[model samples]
Target: MIAAIALAFSFLTATAQAKVLELHRGVGVHEWLNWSPVNEDGTYIWPPYRAEQEWLDSFRKGTVSKGENEFQRIRSMGFDFVRLSVDPGPLVSSEGTKRKEALAILSKAVKRITASGLRVVFDLHGVNQVPATSMKLIYDGADSEGVARYRAMVKEVAGMLVKVGTDKVAIEPYNEPAYYPCDASGTDDWQRIMEATVADIRSVSGDLTIIATGACGGGVKGLLNLKPGFDDPNIYYSFHMYEPHDFTHQRSETKGGFASGMPWPASTSTPEAVRKALEARIDAAGLSRAEKRANLAEADPLIAKYFAENWGEKQLDARFEQALGWAKTNAIPSERLFMGEFGAILMTADGRMGADDADRIRYLTAVRRSAEKAGIPWSIWEYANTYGMSVIVPKENAVPDMNMLGALGLMRQ
Candidate 1:
C-alpha cells in the first residue's frame, strides 16, 4: 500500500509540473538561425550559409563554432526564452532537394535549442523583404498564387513542428509585415492572409501555438488593429517597440543619414545642440544663409519629432498604455500580449557609443521595466554584436556589457 501511494504521488507531481510555459522574458538570438548569408559573388547562395561544411556540421551538433556557448550563456542571464528568427526563402524551394536540405539544418537547430531547456519562438522573419527570387507571396499572400505558395510553406513548417513537437516551440507567421496607412482596409487584408496562414498551419498541427502580428513593420499601432479570426486560446499578438525612430535609430544608416549625439530626455540644451550641429552641417555644405535657414527649417521638425519632444518615462508609459488599452478593449488578456523586440543602438554613425552609458542605461531600464510592470513579456533586440544594442561586446575574448545588462536588470552588480 505504501509503495502504491508513493508511485501515485510521483505521477501526480509530474502531471502538475507539465504546464504550458509562456515566454515572458527573452532575447532575440538573431540572424544566425535565419538563413540569409550572401556569397562573395552578387548571386545568392542556396543553403544561405557562407561557412564551410565542417563548421556547419558542428552547428548542427549544438556548437555555434562562433566561439561562444550560446544556450548556456542565455540561461545564465536569467532569460527564459530565445526568439530564433528564421528566413523562410531558403527553406522553401521549387526543387525538393534544396528545401529538404534546409529543413534538415533547421531541424537540427530546433532540437539543439530545445534540448538546452530554453523555450523557442520560431519566427518566420524577413519573408516580406523582396528576395532575389520573384516571390512576393509574403506581401500578397491574399492573392491566388501567393496564398498557394505561402500555405505550402506553412504546411511544410507545421509538419516539421510535429516532428520537433510543440512542447517548447511556437511559430510567428511573419515578422514586420508592413502596409501603408494601417487603416481598416490594411488591417483586414493582413487579417485575411494571417487567417489563411493559421488555417494552413492548423491543418498539419493543431496543438502548436501561433503568434500573430499586424502590419506597419509590426509596430504598436499596427498590432492594435490586428484581430484574430477565431478566439483560439493558443494565439499570441506580438509588437516590436522602436518608437520615436529618430531617438532609437539615430546615427544608423538604415533609418536615413547619420543622426547622432541626441539625448534621451530632450532638454532645451538638447535641441540647441542639435540646431548647432545642423547649422554646422549646412555651413560645411557651402549653403548661403538663406539656404541654411531653409535647410534648418526642413530639419527642425524631424529633430523635434524624434528627440526634442518630451520622451521620458511618462512618454514610454503612455506608449505602452495605448497597447494595454487596445488589448482591454478587445477583451484580450495581458498574458496574450507580447513585445517581441525592443532595444537601442549603441553605436553612432561614426562608430562610437551614441549616448553615454548612463543615459543609455536610464532609457533601457525605463522601457524594459515599464513593459514588465504591464504584465507583458518582452525580448531585447539582440545578444552579441559590437555596433548594435547588444548586451555582449564582441572581442577575441567576448565580454558582457555590464552596464547594458545592469539596465535590463540582468546584472545586479
Candidate 2:
C-alpha cells in the first residue's frame, strides 16, 4: 500500500514539472516569401513582372507543401518549432494589392506549419535589416504615421493567427531592437517604441504569446539590460549567442578582417603565429610593403585579444553561465529565457568545407550541450542555404548536412 501511494505522488510531481519545463527546439527559416526585390531607386517593383509573380506563386504553394512535408521531416527529427523570419516590406507597403498578397501568404504558411504539428514564432526581422540612416522612416515621431502603420500591420497579423484558432503561434514584435541601455530614462527611444508595440499587440489579442529581445544585435548582455517594465507571464525574453565572435565568425566572407586558418580552441594558434600567416598572405597578394606593414600592425592587437578570450568547452559553458545568471537575477525561469540563435559556419564562401570542420563540429557540440545543460531552448541559425552554417545543403535533391546535424545531435535515426 505504501509503494502504490509513493508511485502516485511521483507521477503527479513529474506531470507538474513537465508542464512548467516545456522547451522549444527550433530552426530559423529566413528570406523566402518575405523578400521583395527593389529597383535602383529603392522602390519596390509592384505588380512584379508576371514572371516574378509566377515564381512567387509557385514558391508560396511550394512553401505550404514544404511546411507540411519538409517540416514534418524536421519534427520527426525531434524539433517542434519554427522561427519564421519575415520581412515586413510587403505587409507595410503602400501598395494595397501587395499588402494583401503578403498577409495571405504568411497566413497560409503559418496555418500549414501549425497543421503539420510545428509551432511558429513569427518574427518581424525586417525592422533590423533596414539601413541605420533610413530607420527613422520606420520609427518616426512618437505618434508618427509610420508607427501607426506598423501597429496596424502587427494587429492584422495577430488577428489572422487568432482566427486560425491555434495557440501554437507566437508573435515577436521586432527582432534585435539594436537599442542599448533601455532604461526608465526617456532617452532610450527604442524601449518606448517596443513598449508601445507590445501594448498594441496585447490590445489586439491578449491570448497570443509574445517573444521579446534587446539591443546591440540582441546579444545576451542586451537581454540582461532590457527593462521591459511591465510583467506578463506569456512574455519570454530571447537573445542570440555568438560569444567570442572572432571564433564563430572568423574569416567570414562578408567581413574577413581576421586571418584565415585561425583554429578553434584558440590555444592552437597564438597571436604571434596568426600574425606571421597574415603577413605571408599580404606579401603573396602583392601589396606595397608599406601597406603590408600597416595591415599587420592593425591586425596584431585584434588577433591577440581574440585568442586570449574564451574559445573552448569550458569557456563556452561560461558564456551560458552568464545567461543563466541573468535569468536568475531577474527571477525568470530558465525555460522562459531562450538562446534564440547560435551556430558555427561549416564552409567558406568558395563552397569549400571550412578549413577546420572538426573544430567547428566541436564548437557546435559545445554550444548545443551547454544550452541543454542550462535548460535554455535554442534554434540553430538556419535550416538551408548557401550560408556556411546551414544544416540543409541546397541542391537538386536536398539533404541535411549530417556532419552538422550530428554535431548538434539532431540526427533523425
Candidate 3:
C-alpha cells in the first residue's frame, strides 16, 4: 500500500509539473548506446564504453572517466536534466536473451542517471543504418512491419519507464522523423504512427508524460506543421531549433576550411566582411597561390547565401513565435512546448569547422535567450562530441567549456 500510494503521489506530482511546465534545462548525452558510428563490420566501435552497469556505476560514483563526477559537474553548471539518447536498434532487432539484456541496460542507465540527481529525457534517437536502426525502420513508413515491431518496443520501454516513475523521466517516442514538406504535400503517415505509438505507451503507463513532435525533420516548421489529433495534459510538444543550418552545421561538408567564421544574426555580418576574414584565414593558412584562389572562389557563393538569408535574433524570435502560435492554436501551454535541441558549432584546432569562440557564444546566447523568452525549456545539441558542437571539449578526462556555459545561460563552474 505504501508503494502504491507513493506511486500515486508521484503521478500527481508529474501531472502538476506538466500543468505548469516544470522547466527541464539539459544537454544531449549521446553515443553511450545511441548507435553512433555503426560499425561497418557490425562490431562495437564505442570505446571508453565497457559494460553499461560498469560505466553507469562509475558515472554515479564519479570516480571514473573524467577523474571527477561528470553528472555532478553538469548539475554544478546548473542543468537539472539530461536528454539521454538511446538507440532502439539493438533491442528491437534482438530476441530472447539478447533483448532481455538490452532492456536491462536501459533500466540501469535510467536508474543510475536518476540516482545521480538528474531527470532523464529518454530520447529514442534513431539513425538510418544498413542493419536498420529505429530511425530507418520507423521512417520506412507508418504501416511497415518495422513500425509494428517498434511500437511493441515502445510499449516495453514505456513499462520500464513507469516502474522508474513518471516524475524522474519522460519518453520522446521518436527522433526527427523523416516526414518532409510539413504540409499537405508531406505524408500523413508519421501522424498516424505517432498517435499509435503514444497509444502503445499509454496502454501500459497512462500517466507517464509523452513528448510528441511534428515531422519534417522535427524542426520548427515541422512542429508548427504537426497536428496532434488529440490532447493529453501529460503530453508535451517538442521541436528542434537549429535554424540557418549553414551557421550551426558550418564546415560539416569538408575540412577545406573556407566556411569557418560566419557570425550569428546575419545582419551582424556581410559578404565582404566574411570574405575578408576568410581571405586572412586563407593567407594565414599559407596555401599555394592556386589553392588560395580556389578556396576563395568556392567561398564566395556560400558567403553570399549566408548574407542573403539575414538570420539574427529577430529571425530566431520569429521562428519561436510561430511555434508559440502553434501551441496556442493547439491549446497547448507554451511551457509544455519543448525545444529539444539547439547549438552552434565552435571552431576547433583540428579539422572540425564552425564559428570562432566569440561568434559562437554570441549565437548561442541568442538561441538560448530566445527559448527562455518564449518560456520553452531546451537542451543543447550535445554534451561532448568531436564535431565542434560539444558543451565540453571531447577528449579523455574532459571538462566543461565556461564560455559555452555562460552563453547557454547555465551557471559556469
Cα lDDT, all candidates? 0.69, 0.66, 0.77
Q: For residues 191-309, could you state the per-residue lDDT of candidate 2 as single tens digits? A: 66667877776666566677777765788767766676743666778888776676666552333333444567787667777667667666666767776666666666667787767
The pairs that clash in candidate 3 are 265-312, 266-311
Which portions of model 2 miss their true places by more than 4 Å?
A: 1-23, 39-41, 46-68, 95-98, 127-145, 181-186, 252-258, 272-299, 349-355, 394-397
Question: 1-413, model 3: which lDDT tens digit per residue?
Answer: 99999987775565545442255688898856675334667643433123553434422434355545567767777888899888777767666676667777788878877887888889888755635654777777889998999888888888888888787889998888877788888788988888898778766765787888889888998887778775678788889988888888777343565667788777777888887877787777677798777777777787788888788877888999999999898887788889999988787564236788888888889888888887788998888676778877755546678889889877655
Candidate 3 — number of clashing residue pairs? 2
On residues 194-283, what C-alpha lDDT tens digit does candidate 1 reach at each position? 778877776665567778888778888887777765546667788888866666765533323334555676653467786686566546
Which runs of model 1 end up more than 4 angstroms from their true locations? Answer: 1-20, 38-68, 127-135, 185-187, 252-258, 267-269, 274-301, 349-353, 394-396
TM-score of model 3 relative to the true fold? 0.87
lDDT of 1 at 67: 59
RMSD of each: 7.3, 8.5, 4.8
- Which stretch of 10 consecutive residues in model 2 shows the poorest summed lDDT? 47-56
Instruction: Estimate the TM-score for candidate 2.
Output: 0.78
Give candidate 2's error at residue 39 in angstroms: 4.3
**Count of steric clashes across candidates, in order:** 1, 0, 2
Which ranking of candidates, highest lDDT first?
A: 3, 1, 2
TM-scores of the candidates are: 0.80, 0.78, 0.87
